[model samples]
Target: MTTIADRVRELTVAREPFVHATVVRAQEPTSARPGDAAVVLPDGSIEGFVGGVCAESSVRAAALDTLRDGATLLLRVLPDDTATFPDTPGARVVVNPCHSGGAIEIFLRPVLPAPVLGLAGGTPISVAVATLAEFLDFEVAASGDYAGATAVVVAGLGKGEQDAIRAALDAGVGFVALVASRKRGAALLDELALTDAERARVHTPAGLEIGARSPQEIALSIMAEVVRAIRVDGLASSPGPAAARPQQAVDPVCGMTVLVGPETPHARVDGRDHWFCCAGCHASFTAA
Candidate 1:
């Protein structure tokens, strides 16, 4: 039997996005208890139980919102009488209309797909950026071949920086940054003579203004901006889908991530190929 932890690992490895919801508090007449958990899928189906159908609906809605915004939420579903829909920072409140007459507090944590972050240089600052990005759950690559990168940071010591930047731009990377001094970055941009639209895609200075002094601090600043580009600014405008999106599928029986391939064991259900990790998984899915 695959445990929930095992399922989570499979999802992370396959880069499939989902939400993990834990019941931290459950009031009287509730079907859930503290520490109860559920995996909420993109389609609002839950693999585990946090509460009854009423509470599950609320969890699914909040989970979808967290996935879309990439934000953690502390959700409170309260009974109707005292439901004021309190406004709090980093928290959200929803009333359970099922009138279960029970209050439940569930913490929803989003497990989003890791975006590829490409670093063009091998400098100390670039290395630091990769380290920090990995810590923040970004798939970091230190090469010019940003074939799977949604964001690219160019800081090569005048070596292959231009080529990297051009390739990222041509590939329609969502965010392209040049990690250079203000003046030098400006001069390089002038030399590139990119179209206004293309230039808009490049972030000169490549980071927030934090008055950073050391390479590590500079890298931190750049990565902060990179996150904003993907989670904040990038979502504000419609973007064309990049070529680097990974193909992923979810196992209906165990909620594990399944890589679609001919060699992998699979079954065609409802006119779609449902891949599985092993023969056991396929059998379990078929039985279900």
Candidate 2:
């Protein structure tokens, strides 16, 4: 059997986002005891067990939510009739219909890889961006590879800046910005044969209008814009269904968001379709 430590090491080295669930409190009739731990992978699979199928479903759901929102969770799973749940701030309560008559408290924490910022040029501004990004808790890459970078910044040093920007855009990096004067930036953009949509993706004169003069100030402005772009990208990428309806369904058992698709387990109840993260959730939903 693989231990939690072994799984943690494996996941850490692989840079996969996961949630660690540990049972800190357990009442009678529960299959799990305090200290039981489990790891929930990105796909809603549990590598360990915190309790029986019912408890596992809830834990899995909470774990996935934590991964998505990058927030730690303290979950309390009780029977459907549980009324006097512990009044605690930030504690999520899950009503378990299939529980044998026990309560389980599981703590879930998300382990996510740091977002990467790729720097294309080794100019003073690039160096400053790297330093400042590090301060902002982003992993900085100076190679301009953009292979796995969430954002790329071309700190122009007069040579190869256009090439770097071209490479970044060609690679479909979600966010790309170039630091240069308006004239130089315009000239370089004219040279590139990018479509209007693609050209619009490039943020020329990268950074906010903070009147930045020095390389350090420019770096700060660029980072601010980068952060804004990241947030905008996130909102645009997952705006749910049209008309603002959520494309993803929240698993009622555990509250994890499940993309509505054939592969996802789902059930139709009360003339409505509900998706679940896993079989365990489906079972719990049916039982309820």
TM-score of each: 0.63, 0.77
Name the runs in model 1 displaced over 4 angstroms. Answer: 78-93, 97-101, 123-125, 135-137, 143-150, 157-159, 179-193, 204-288
Q: What is the C-alpha lDDT profile of model 2 across 1-288, one tens digit per residue?
A: 779979988997776778888999988888899999988887677788799766776776677778778889999988877744576799999876656778889999999777788788787888899999999988888775676667788876566887887777766676788888888888888888778977887888899999999999999999999888767556122111222222567777766555554467888999998887678778988997
**Candidate 2, which segments miss by more than 4 Å at Cα?**
157-159, 232-288
* Lowest-sum lDDT 10-residue window in model 1: 237-246
The worst-scoring run of ten residues by lDDT in candidate 2 lies at 235-244
Q: What are the per-residue Cα lDDT tens digits for candidate 1 across 1-288?
A: 776667778888887778988898888787889998878767666787788755765676678778877788998877667654446687777764343677788999899777888788888888889889999988887756676577888886595777788888887676788988789888888888889988888898888999998989998999999888766666222234322322456556545444444555689988987876456677878888
**Backbone clashes in model 1:** 0
